[model samples]
Target: MHAHTATRPVALVTGAGRTSNIAAATARTLAAHGWDVAFTYYRPYDARMPWGAEEGAARALHAAITEYGARALGVEADLADPQAPARLMDTVADRLGPATALVLAHCESVDSGLLDTTPESFDRHFAVNTRAAWLLIREYALRLKAPHGAGRIIALTSDHTAHNLPYGASKGALDRITLAAATELAHLGVSANALNPGPVDTGWMSAEHARQLRSATPLGRLGTPQDCAHLIEFLCSARGGWVNGQLITSNGGLA
Candidate 1:
């Protein structure tokens, strides 16, 4: 953690364990735009994924954020634990300050559908994707200190439920919970919205799959972490306050 800059607002971005992902990109973008960043990541979850955890990713990301002259803290948190959300908020407050912006880019996705989707996997997805999101929002709302129209909350969502049942269903629930905050927290001048950035490679797509996706999209290219980060930066700014209670898609017109 670096010196607290009262002039710059603090943003807590979840799921930024790796330097290659959207959350890491968002942290860098926010720091460059005059916002201190505190991000959370669960190494155990990433280790289990097809793309194994990148060693020392959190420390590397912290250094990357500070390069832009902003304070940064990378916390290792398992959002699956029901108690983690409040603890994360307290930790951020102790280190940086109360976060004015909350961006949930974390998820528990294992790509099992229908019969293959076990009950434990379903429960885990809801616990992290849906329940943790609600808890984090609650914590943010309780501890927020931003001025009118300065509080912002953004959740990354998806509409793909066919072969990715649990993950998609949980994200669907996340969307509703996030949108509910937009109206419920209106008195605090907070705006909540869900963004669906379709088909970001992020080491998830194979060479063939990436080519196929690129060919199907009108833009003739794939979405990158920076593409999503730019929109997140916009939503956290004063200009994006009015885009409340909506689900915005930034997919480069994918077919």
Candidate 2:
């Protein structure tokens, strides 16, 4: 049953497991701008992190989207699986129609240096952050039914590689994959770009760490999920279609 009659564009945002995260913010912002939003989350990943899973966050996000007069679907997806990307794309298409915007905010980030990083951990990071992104983009481009120049792909990336080798390396690969979509998917008129939103504390930072970062940033505060969400809202808009194929840093000039 197709719920989309093209009355509003659809957006597929991954990693929206937590209501306070960037992906959740992006989903709500897009919905407010007349988009039907479908988001994926893996609670197991959040459970493994220092910030344990937020129970019922996805339900709350769906309710929020509906409050904005937009349809919403939440799926529990483990992007580490090679098959998950295609399944995700298909599920979103079946429910809300083909997504015009694909926001990849999912990641496998476990802090380990070159010596401490295990082979299994490295492989998992690449599987989730790099290969999954590539596969998702491929699925999206192939299944795209949106009109020409209407497709958008936005990937969130980071450059923190000192103590976090595998995560950063895989993200570097993701950046390349996203940028390649800009040229390769040109035939389909899909504009792709990577965005680095530096140090937005979504409950992972110590108070001291947050204060240090706040003082370091030229803007005298940490970046917020809304900061990234607003920029992504623009990137997914028709007006932002021209600003493609670039790696944009939306950090508040942290030095």
Candidate 3:
């Protein structure tokens, strides 16, 4: 492994779609903690995917990270493509040396319920959520192996996994996939873990929906991107090194 100067670390975060997006918040949080960030976004042709607004969001995040005095690269990629993860990683490495931290937060097709879910939908989710994570970890391990200072991989899961929705099931699969990788990579100085969040107020959820979720949550409030980002920032730090192979739920104390 090529050694990097110990002064500041570099991180790559995928799926940072909007400034209010959880992944974008996590990137800013990490930057505040002194890590340079490289982030990715997906642009879909569909009118529902909010692809057109991502460039503006990326610009805002770039400003936030820079305000923290860290370098930031905001890349637009289509994670639905099987080869996109490797290409995204290459872009990140080209912009900011080898990464010490990686965050897989890309998600697609949340509209697929059990009755409407198709094989194609399942495969798409698996490819973008689980398989992409696998490819990223594989590449990360190949590059940084043991003797490196506790490389970290953090995957964003969903509370729906526990509720067993079709989309949730996909996230559950992602959690399991991450755990398997963590078990194998822990001995090699890398740690992998998943973070699950409940209903978050990301402006995508309607006000009525957010209010209903807040009523259901024990904390009497809906989660915010910043709430999730705080925990992710901790996970990427030295303070969170011992937290490995676990699916941590940050749902305002909700089960």
Candidate 4:
């Protein structure tokens, strides 16, 4: 906790525990750009994924963010909890002033199709992917003291409905929910957009899958966390202020 004075700009990022993740990369990019950062993560969720959870992803991310000489804080939180989003905002404000931007990179990714969809699974995905995002965007707008157009809310999305029903459907909801936030919050200096980064290898791809993904993209490679982070940087910048209520695709022609 650096206890920064002078009202340093801050960004609150969720799912930014793993160093190999987009959340971590975005946090790093934000830090490098003179923004103090706070992040939240839930390891239990990550543990359920094929790519097992990293033991101290929060600690490692904190270290990396602070290395840029910016204050950093990481909270182990389950966004699926309705109360968690508000608590996260309060914690971030208490530690690092009000945030000017929010980047949501957390998701519940279970591989199940139409037949795989269950009450529990669908609800869990909605809890994290859709509900949490809605709350976070709302809270960010309400918490901000900045003038209209200073608030930035960006969420990561995917279109994997065929193979991953719950995950894809929930993210689809996230896209609309965040866009609605953009439309409603535009008067408050808040710009919201969804970035759909298709098929990135964040340790979630097999060698053959990675090769297939690379072959599918015209760039002949899969996306990187940093690639998404760079777009985030722009969206949070003055130049990207006009880009609002749009679902910008950052895929290297992997559609």
Off by over 4 Å in 1: 1-6
lDDT of 1 by residue, 1-255 (tens): 212234889999999978899999999999998898999999999899889999999999999899999999999999999999999999999999999999999999999889899999999999999999999999999999988789999999999899999999999999999999999999999999999999897998999999999999999999999999999999998878789999999999999
Question: All predictions: root-mean-square deviation over Cα?
Answer: 2.4, 2.5, 3.1, 2.6
Tens-digit lDDT string for candidate 4 (32-74):
8778999888888777777778997888888888888999999
- What is candidate 3's CA lDDT for residue 38? 92
Listed per model in order, the count of residue pairs whose N, CA or C atoms clash below 3 Å is: 0, 0, 0, 3
Ranking by lDDT: 1, 2, 4, 3
- What lDDT does each candidate get? 0.94, 0.93, 0.77, 0.87
Q: Which ten residues in a row have the lowest lDDT in candidate 1?
A: 1-10
Q: Please give the TM-score that candidate 2 achieves against the real structure.
A: 0.97
Superposing every Cα of model 2 onto the true structure, what RMSD results? Answer: 2.5
Off by over 4 Å in 3: 1-5, 45-47, 50-55, 145-147, 161-166
Off by over 4 Å in 2: 1-6
TM-score for each model: 0.97, 0.97, 0.90, 0.95
Judge candidate 3 at residue 168 and give its lDDT: 74
In model 1, state the lDDT of residue 184. Answer: 99
Displacement of residue 33 (Cα, Å) in model 2 is 0.5
> What's model 4's lDDT at 53?
83
